[model samples]
Target chain A: MAEYKGVMTYCEIAEGSLPSISREVAGFGRKLADDLGEELCAVLVGSDVGNLAQDAIGLGADTVYVVDDPLLKEYQTDAYLSVMEKVVRKMMPRILILGQTSVGRDLAPMLAFRLDTTATLDCVGLAIDPGTKLLLQTKPVFGGNAQATFTSDFCPQIVTVRDKLMPPPEPDASKQGEVITLDAGLDPAAIRASLLKRVTENEGGVRLEDASIIVSGGRGIGSAEGFDQLQELAALLKGAVGASRPACDNRWLAPNRQVGITGKIVNPDLYIAIALSGSIQHLSGCAQSKSIIAINKDPEAPIFNYADFGVVGDWKKVLPAFRDKLKELLPG
Target chain B: MRIIVCIKQVPDPQASSSGTKVDPEAMRVIVPQGTPPVMSPYDENALEAAIRIKDAHGARVTVISAGRNLAKPVLRKSLASGADELVLLEDAAFEKLDSYATAHLLVAAIREIGEYDLILCGRQAADTDAGQVGSGIAEILKIPCITAASKVELSDGKVLVERVVSDGFEVIEAPMPALVTASSEIGDLRYPKLKDLQAAQKMPITVRGAQALGIDAAGLKRVNLVRLAEPPRRKTECRIIGGETPEEAGANLALKVKEAKLL
Candidate 1:
């Protein structure tokens, strides 16, 4: 293994701009570097991505590594992983931190396999041991019913932090770091997969992860017709519609709209749990929400504890009134 | 063309847990029996994708699964859904293998089945939700893997697939003999007809042991799991806004939301 003694953070760039998760990872990496008394180096791989390297330095990276190649304009798992593997082999950092975005999810596992190491994914917390210099990673397990803490006995500890797990870094204009441009060894034929086209959805609504107001439902919504009421409420409140695991299981909503540890972790300003008995898996994902509202017929439901507001009446009667009240309270 | 789809039977997501105690002798956890075993929801998507491919390309699709004898019911469901053949990798020792060993065992079974043009699997299993087996199998077999595939189209000599990314999707094109993990959006699955179910009962199913696949079940190791326990019960203190009418309850809830600063 290549031997470089520093913490390396993999910064993801999209549309020639840095993603928010990258800064969060950089902040966490800075903390880890401080604890280890080592420099934090940032690695950026993409086409025409050099302009974003300065943002990484502003986020607390002391050094930035850039692999700018035309072949990397689109992410192919094989080509991207090959460049990452080459960089890691050349500069063997003590720890590798990646943002648990889609790219991170695909690349981290492949990189770990190539490096013959283990990668802890979707970590919600991170800490470094001063004496041992080991990275302690914490993540929810068993569909969020439990949390597990793990550490690697091997070198080059790798962890992927879930999005929004850490606060984004505060920028300091006065801080300037060195930028090193490296050649990305690219072989087009080596990339088994090639991109043909990209289709993006146009519908606009609150993104589940970043939404401030989330109005959610569960299996008790009864039918597809019930979703119309939930959607109407979400629209009236300028919020997003989320579903519990049971709702997703019943195909009441798309899996992408599901909220839970296994689904999406949401920290909304107001979380409305409608016709849903809160399960542990669902609670773990929404526990960080500022306020929770439970609307269920069963007065003894588990969601009441997490909910700041509770409505014991049936949703059919409760939701319409609630929607009208919100309209009166905040006219749009 | 022959396509192989590896599936697993897991507890239904909605099933209540079987009351298995973390410390059974000590009376720790009472996880009631979870829902009955069924073809994993994700795997059903994979199976549906495979069936679509067969219908469009006239390909032979084989459904392969690993589990206890109780899994026969679940395996029959796959057969009823239009799989041309069924193979069950069964053994008492196969029950406890982790994802790594599971991948190895599946690879051995695939090798025993001879050459195949393509392989498909669910992105992850519902029970463990590991999302590792498909990738691990691809790694072991040294083949290209496209995961979380939202769309797949085959033409000429290449297979085109769109894998879901965080911000967007990354479209990938791979040659035959590639592996893909189906996402939920692959297609909507159809329920089996009565005729299909009856025909599935007459379909031949080949059951094999781990030894037949050249995997030493004894070598499999459990990395962790001191015990299993039920998740802690959530405590709820219901604050019933006692009101004679729904509007009064709505007002009371509005007050609570304002006090909580949820507005």
Candidate 2:
């Protein structure tokens, strides 16, 4: 057996705090580390994010590694990679976990490549094989038609977990842990990419992952007006409005709100899929939701196969009436 | 300037595999008949990005791929779509490569190209959906990598790109001789004209095997597929609402959903 040591998680800082996905990953990684009887460590990299290091500890990291530097204020691959590679080489943890965000999706593979290993991306389920003591990474394969479990032969196994699948850890303010700040030796001349500016969409402060209820539309919604109705319903319920890949591909919605295999994986308490034919890829992402209600005109749509309640009707006529009924029923 | 685009051939993603079965003995997914394989959609975006760069600046667009039993029509379609040259790396031993091994082969082929100002690839492959190869190649080649690039433009000896993020998009500028993975926002792939399609048929394709590249044919296996099985199906006795009109059905559904307290 390989003598791997600890469980390390990469905690990303966005808007001066850890994103919801990082909190979920840390929660899951903490349990896995405890099961293996190993130390739980968190890696945080940014300009002035030492405070987030303490937040990671409160969320259950035993040791928090901090790499604070001005060059790392914005995430450039080389600068962050330089710090992470050194940390991994020095610590040599058994398992490396990361949130499957755009940054993680890009950095994990490069780190695994440098370490001569492979990674499992967008994994939905994870468990340890009791006999072999290996991480069993389960992910959707073949465009989400089937599921595949993969294990790496390398010592430090790398895994990128999907967002909204795992629950976020409860923070304990009184928890104490060790924090170590390392010298980030980055040479500005060696970095090739520079951040010019970041442009963000005004999404009204609602993120898809944190919402408990989601009302999603698909291409069958007919036009942008359909999404407007869906948004009205979502607003009434105080939930987020999501869309399928086709809707995003058609520019009916922003790509950020897409929920499917290629987009965000959501685990809301209730998922209302409207005018969407449930493709395997789309189902795989939302499969873990507690309850699902599907609405489509076609009775034979695959969505009904997995939906708890199915309504067959044209969205144009149905959505407006549904909204009116809901408003009437739950008048504040 | 020379631009290299790496494309992959995958089964059509939109094809429903309700009747498809897994060949556990061979470790392959058997697609339903009549669903011809096409270039992965994001890779099509990558090719389009390269061609657009070539159109803006005079550059040669060379497209490359690594797979077994390379399809002629698929590879020719890329050339017809505007790639100046095509290179296919095929071998029996290359069948079960993980991202690491695939990146090794691509980096070798790219090194052979000798002179390239930029390399482009899809954000992720449609089949495995593992988006590791592009970053792997960039890391091995010691070049900068910009991933999930929705828009790419060539400037004076540098490239400016808009990358998709969780919140929105970030504009990044990188020096020449870098790699970028294209997202669907790059734009729709252009259709080849009749003359371009005719010229693509006459264009020569460079094919290489493991032996041709001085690699051991039998020793290239790195990652192993442990098992493949159907995911546990969600069994639900769906209670479908039936009404004379869409409005009636919608009103009933709202009442039912409200009764269930799902909202």
Best by TM-score: 2
lDDT of model 2 at residue B242? 64
- Residue-level lDDT for A83 in candidate 2: 82
Candidate 2 Cα deviation (angstroms), residue A91: 1.3
lDDT of 2 by residue, A120-230 (tens): 888877777787778888877877877788887686888899887756989988999999998888888867788789877747846787788899998898777778888
Error of 2 at B203 (Å): 2.2
Q: What lDDT score goes with residue A9 in model 1?
A: 96
Q: lDDT of candidate 1?
A: 0.77
For residues A1-332, could you state the per-residue lDDT of candidate 1 as single tens digits?
Answer: 33648899999887778878888899999998998888999999999999888888999999999999999987778888889988988888989999877777777766765675657677777888567567777665545544555666555777788876656978876788999999997888878866777655313777777678998998789877898898898888788888886676566776567777556778887888999888766887787787788888888776887776788878888878777777777746
Off by over 4 Å in 1: A1-5, A35-38, A127-137, A150-156, A219-232, A244-256, A277-281, A298-302, B17-31, B67-70, B91-96, B167-172, B187-189, B193-204, B216-238, B245-248
If you score just chain A, what TM-score does every candidate get? 0.93, 0.93
